[model samples]
Target: MYRYDEFDQQFVSARVEQFSDQVRRRLSGELSEDQFKPLRLMNGVYLQLHAYMLRIAVPYGTLNTRQLRKLAHLARTYDRGYGHFTTRQNLQFNWPSLEQIPDMLRELAEVQMHCIQTSGNCIRNVTADHFAGAAADEIVDPRPYAEILRQWSSLHPEFSFLPRKFKIAVSGAAHDRAAVRIHDIGLQVVKNDEGQIGFTVFVGGGLGRTPFIAWTLRDYLPEADLLTYCEAILRVYNLYGRRDNKYKARIKILMHEAGLDTVRAQVEEEFERIRGGVLTLPEGDVARIRAYFAPPAFESLPAVSLVETQTAARDPGFAAWVATNTHAHKVPGYVSVTISLKPVGGIPGDASAEQMEAVADLADAHAFGEVRVSHQQNLILPHVKRDDLPAVYRGLVAAGLATANAGLVTDIICCPGLDYCSLANARSIPVSQRISERLGDPARQAEIGPLLIKMSGCINACGHHHVGHIGILGVDRKGEEFYQITLGGSADEVSAIGDITGRGFSSAEVVDAIDTIVNTYIAHRASPDETFLAAYRRLGMQPFKEALYGNA
Candidate 1:
């Protein structure tokens, strides 16, 4: 994690003081609600349907043990006893009092975390792969670049008030775990033939009322010109993106109207003008940012461990958990452990204050004190020793984080729909909870195999439903809760947005509809080995649609 320097410290402290004064003015009647609206939003505060919601940024989804502990403290002392980890790798507190937010911000600042740019029509948190540095397939860690973008875009004068919110994601692994295609800007770090690292930049990719898969703007953007090229894309969008209608203000609409070629051409023209200006990322500056993300030391050990194999044989529960929750690490004798937030009927990403604290302690004790928040709404101890698996699992089980449902059906990614978001038309969390309860059996989920089921409350696509293998989007019809299902969507190297199966289903019918789709795939798949995505790709959505709608 990057430690805050004096400038960074001063900037955050000043912002906190400013926001505190603004809140005081609002309370004292010196500033009306209308006047306080923008000020509150700029500080990541939202007046939700029920209460004030504050989103706190977790930069590039990386945090140290101390930071995790601070989040736990916030949850315990300030708002409710839990925090909702969002799809963008940030956390949201649903019930923060308006007056206490500044104190909360100060607490966050102590740990080098803040809510700046977490919301409100500006560049939001930049997400990267959870396994950025530790993934076996990574060419380079994407966090340094993400941090650079964070610094450059924070309180940027020209882009402080865009037409709508902007999101950017980065991924270094061949697998697109970051869902880069569904963001305003997606940067995939790739190595050229000569082994020099660069980015493959994608633009106009977003999910909302209008979902668009981003188009590759450049095949290879040099490391030095990342900010310059990014500035060009934003300049193009800022100048021409629709602003008359809030729904169409996103760059996706601009891409739809201007055509990708025309937009790319304009961006290219702008890039040439600013390639060597203030936006140019200098070599030493890059080095300075990279220094903050240095890799942890690992001890060499033999590949196959008899103790681990024996432990697996002794306890089927631990074995299953190890099989699902643990991932391959770049180093030998170390495994990446995913602490699942989705246990059985629990909320998808709600971690209690105690759970957060336990995760921090586990990270410190077993994994070099580094923690990562996954885009899938889980926490990762990226470098746990294989020998510490049982102890870690015990700790996680006690904390309700030891769900062996990673990549399984119950490991749902959901947005805080009507429950917390004012813009939501339907409730997303309850639907997710219902589906999860219906599919609560761990054995059943394991047998069902690998699946990515994502839910968004509305077309805003905060839950990233468009990219889930089975996507669920909540909608409202005549003031009733309804759900629209999309199938075969993937967010990987071969990413494709899922297609709507047919008519919407009522809230009660939605879970059964999902079950029908899964059962249909199970019955009609080519072999037992064929995954849901594979079978869907082979046969298309008609069979599943027919099964769900029943000969409509």
Candidate 2:
């Protein structure tokens, strides 16, 4: 994890002071709601349906146990006992009072965390794979690069007010866990023909009203020119991206209208102008950043833990948890454990203050005092020793953070819809809750295999319904909630937008429809080993549609 330097510390301290005064003015009526809107938004405060929601950036989804404990304290002191982890790998205090926000910001600043750049029409939090440094399949760790971009883009003069909000996500592994293709800017670590490390840059991918898979702007961007090339893309977008229509303001719409070649040519021209300039990252600077992210010390141990194997062999519950919730680590004796926030019928990413503190404690005891937030709304202990799996599981179970379902059907990604979001046309949480309850059994989910059921309250795609294996979109029809289903979507290396199934289901019929879809896939899949995504892609949407609407 990258720690703030003296300059970084001073910068945050100044911003917190500025925002604190701004908040005071707003509360005292010196600033009206209309006058305070931009100020509050700039500070990451959103006036949601019921109350204010403060989104705090979790840079590259990495936090030390101390930072996590501080957040737990803030959640306990202010708000209503819980914080919601968002699809951006950020945390949102959904019920924070406007008056309490300044103190909250001050508290966050104490731990090198802040709500800066979390909202408004500028660069948002730069996210990377949650398993960045630890994943066995990763080519390189992308967080250091992400941090570099953060340093360059934070409070940059030019991009302060783009056509709309911008999001950048980085993925270092071959598997694309960061949903790279669906961000305003996506960077994938790649090795060139010369065996030199670089990036494969994608531009204009986003998932709002008009979802788009980013175009390959540069197949191989040299590591040194990262900032320069990135500046070129931003310059082109800022120069021509729409400002008239809010709906068409995103870079994705620009990519759709301008075409990839046109944008690429413009970006290349800009890059040529800026290359070898101040923006080019020096080798020493790169090395320094890389050194900051060096892996923690590990004891020399065998690949398999004998105690772990024996315990799992005895306890079916432990075996199930181990089977689903743990991932292979780069280090032989360690594993990355996923603490699923999705309980049987709980809100997808809502973690209570107590739960956060417990996870912080677990990270201190087992992991390297580090906690990670996954884009899929789960918390990750990125470096847990395999030998300590049972004790970790027990601790998680005690804290109500143990849900055993990671990639299974019940491990759903859902947005807070009509319940909290003002933009929602329908309720997403209760619907997902019902679906979870319907398929909550561990055996049933295990049988179903890896399934991603994402639900969005609207077309904003906050739940990433665009790329879900079983995608559900809620729409308002004649003052009633109707859910639309999309099939065969995935957010992996072979990213694909889900195809819509005809018509919509009533809220009452939605869960049953999902069951129908799942059962249809199970019946038609070639083997138990075949995943829901594979089955859907193999059989196409015909069988699933027939099952949902009936052949008649």
Candidate 3:
């Protein structure tokens, strides 16, 4: 993880005091609610339907044990006993009091964390692959670039107040775990024919009322020009992106309205103007940032762990967990573990303070004192020794975090809908909970194979429902909660928005509808090995549509 320097410490400390004064002014009636709105948003505070929500950025989803422990402390002291991990790999406290937020910010600052740029129409947290350095197929770790962007964009005067909020994601692996295609700016690390590293740049990708898979802006962007190219894109968006209506303010909308060719021309022109300027990343600076993310000291061991094999043979539960939750690592005898937050019938991403502390302890003991927050609302121990699998599994089981449901139907990505967000039309968490319960059986999940079910409360698409294998959107129909389903959505390398399956269903009918879809896939799939996504793509939506609505 990148340690905060003295400058970072001083900057965060100053911002804490600055925001503390603002909060005090609001409480003292010196600032009215309308006046405090923008100020609070700039600091990552939101006045939700029930209470104030605080979103703390976990840059590139990296966290050390110290930071994790600090978050646990915040969850225990400041807000409710639990905190919500979001789709952006950030953490949210939904019930924090307005006055206590300053204290929370101070606590976060102590751990080199903050909520800046978490909200508002600015470049939000720069995200990367959760398994960046450890992934077996990574061309390079993307976190260093993400950190560089963070340093460059924080409080940037030129791009601070864009037409709308912008998000950027980077993926280093050939397999797109970062969902880069659905970001405002997506950078996929690629190696040229000469073996020089660079990026395949994609722009205008986003999800909301309107969704788009980012168009390719550059086939190969030199590694040195990363910052310059990003700046050029932002400049183009800032100048011409829609500002009159919030609905059409995103860069994706600009791409839709202005056409990709025109936008490409404009970006190319801006790139030429600023290509060799101060924003150009230097080799020395890149090396310096890259050093901060060097691999941990790993010992030589057998490629396969006999201890893990023996333990799994003894414990079927551990065996099932290993099958579902672990990923192949770059280093032999090691694996990345996904700690599923979506336990059957529980809230998707809610982790209690005690669970947070337990994970911190596990990271210290099993991992290299490091933790990663996955965009799928899961925690990841990115480098765990295969030999220590049993102990790690035991700790997770004790903490109730051992739900062997990674990438399964039960591993749902859902947002806090009407329960927390004022903008929500209907409840999302309840629907997710019901679906999880319906498909909670481990055997059933294994049979269904890899499937992603994402739900959003409204069109804001906070839950990333647009990219799920099965997407659920909650809508308010005549004062009653109704749910709509979209099939064949995917967030991987071949990203696509889902297709709606005819009319909406009542809340009571939504879970059954999902069950029907799953059963239809099971029956129609050529074999058990065929994934829900692959089968859906092969068979198309007609079969599922017919199963759901029966030929109109």
Candidate 4:
């Protein structure tokens, strides 16, 4: 994790003081709701359906035990005892009072975290692969670059207010776990033939009412020009992106209206103007940032843990958990463990304060005192020793954080729908919960193989439903909640928006529809080895649609 310097500390402290006064004015009636709207948004405060929502940035999804403990304290003391981890790899406190937000901000500042640029139509939190430095197949750690972007873009005068909110994701691994293809700007770290590191830049990728996979802007952008290239793209978007309609203000919409060639030409022109300028990243700076993210001290041990093997032989529960929750690590004797927040029949990403504290304690004790928030709404101990798997699993089980459902049907990605978001058309959490419960069986999930089910309450696509293997979108149809299902959506390296399976289903019929779809996949797949996504891609929507509508 990148520790904040003097400048960062001072900047955050000053912002807290500034927002404190703004909040005070609003509470004192000196500032009306209309006047405070932008101010509140700039500080990551949203007036939700029931209460104020505060989104705190977890840069590139990285956190240390101290920071995690602070979040748990905030959730316990300020909010209703739980916090919602979002698809952006951020955390939201749903019940924080407006008056108490400044205090919360102050606490976060102490831990080098803040809410700035979290809500506004600016460059939001820069995301990266959750397993960045520890991934077995990473070309490089993308978090250093993400941290650099954060430092550069925070309160940037040029991009302070864009046509719409922009999101950027970086992936160092070939697997594309960061979902780079679905971001406003996606950077995939690549090595050239000469073994020099650079990025494969993609632009115009986003999901909403209109979804798009980002077009490749540059097949290879030099590592030194990362900032300059990104700035050039932003400049192009800012100058030409639509400002008339909020619906079409995103860069993705601009890419749609203006052809990719034209946009690329414009970006190239801008890059020519700004290349090798002040924004050009220096080797020293890159090295400095990289040092902050150096790999932890790892001991030499066998690749396979005999203790873990023996324990799993005895305990089928642990065996299942190891299969689903643990990921391969770059280091031989270590693995990344995903502590699932999505228990069957529970909310997808909501973690109680106690759970947060428990995770913090476990990270401190077993892992490297570090935790990562996955975009899939799960917490990861990114460098856990294979030898300590049993003890960690036991601790997680005790804390009720031991749900072995990572990348499974029950491990859903969902937004705070009609329950919390005023923009939502129908409830999302309930639908997600119902689906999870329906497919809660471990054996069933194992049989289904790796599947991602993402749900959004509305077209805002906050839940990233557009990229799920089974994407569920909730809509209000004649005062009744209905869901539109999309199949074959994926957020991996070969990213594609899901295809809608004909008509929307009533809330009552949606879960059954999902079950029908799953059963159809099971029956149609060549073998159990074929994943739901692979089967859907091979078979297409006709079979699932026929199964759902039944030859209507």
Show pairs that collide, candidate 4: none
Q: What is the per-residue lDDT of model 3 for residues 1-552, given as tens digits with 9 covering 90 to 100?
A: 799999999999999999999999999999999999999999999999999999999999999999999999999999878999999999999999999999999999988999999999999999999999999999899999999999999999999899999999999988999999999999999999999999999999999999999999999999999999999999999999989999999999999899999999999999999889998889999999999999999888788999999999999999999999999999999999999999999999999999999999999998999999999999999999999999999999999999999999999999999999999999999999999999999999988989999999999999999999999999999999999999989988999999999899999899999999999999999999999999998999999999999967
Tell me the TM-score of each prediction against the true structure. 0.98, 0.99, 0.99, 0.99
* Error at 121, model 1, angstroms: 1.7
lDDT of 2 by residue, 1-552 (tens): 788899999999899899889888988999999999999888899999999999999999999989988888888899888899989999999898989998999899899999998999999999999999999999999999999999999999999999899999899988899999999999999999998889999998888688888899999999999999999999999999999999999999999999999999999999999899999999999999999899999888789999899999998988989999999999899999999999999999999989999999999999989999999999999998999999999999899877889999999999999999999999999999999999998889888999999999998999999899999999999999999999988887888899999999999999999999999999999999999998887889898888888886
Question: How accurate locally, in lDDT, is each candidate?
Answer: 0.90, 0.93, 0.95, 0.95
Q: Can you write out model 4's per-residue Cα lDDT over 446-473, one digit (the tens) per residue? A: 8898899999999999999999999999
Regions more than 4 Å wrong, model 1: none
Q: Residue pairs in steric clash, candidate 1?
A: none
RMSD of each: 1.1, 0.8, 0.6, 0.7
- Give per-residue lDDT, candidate 2, residue 12: 93
How many backbone clashes can be found in candidate 3? 0
Better of 2 and 4 by lDDT: 4
Better of 2 and 3 by lDDT: 3
Q: Whole-model lDDT for model 2 versus the true structure?
A: 0.93
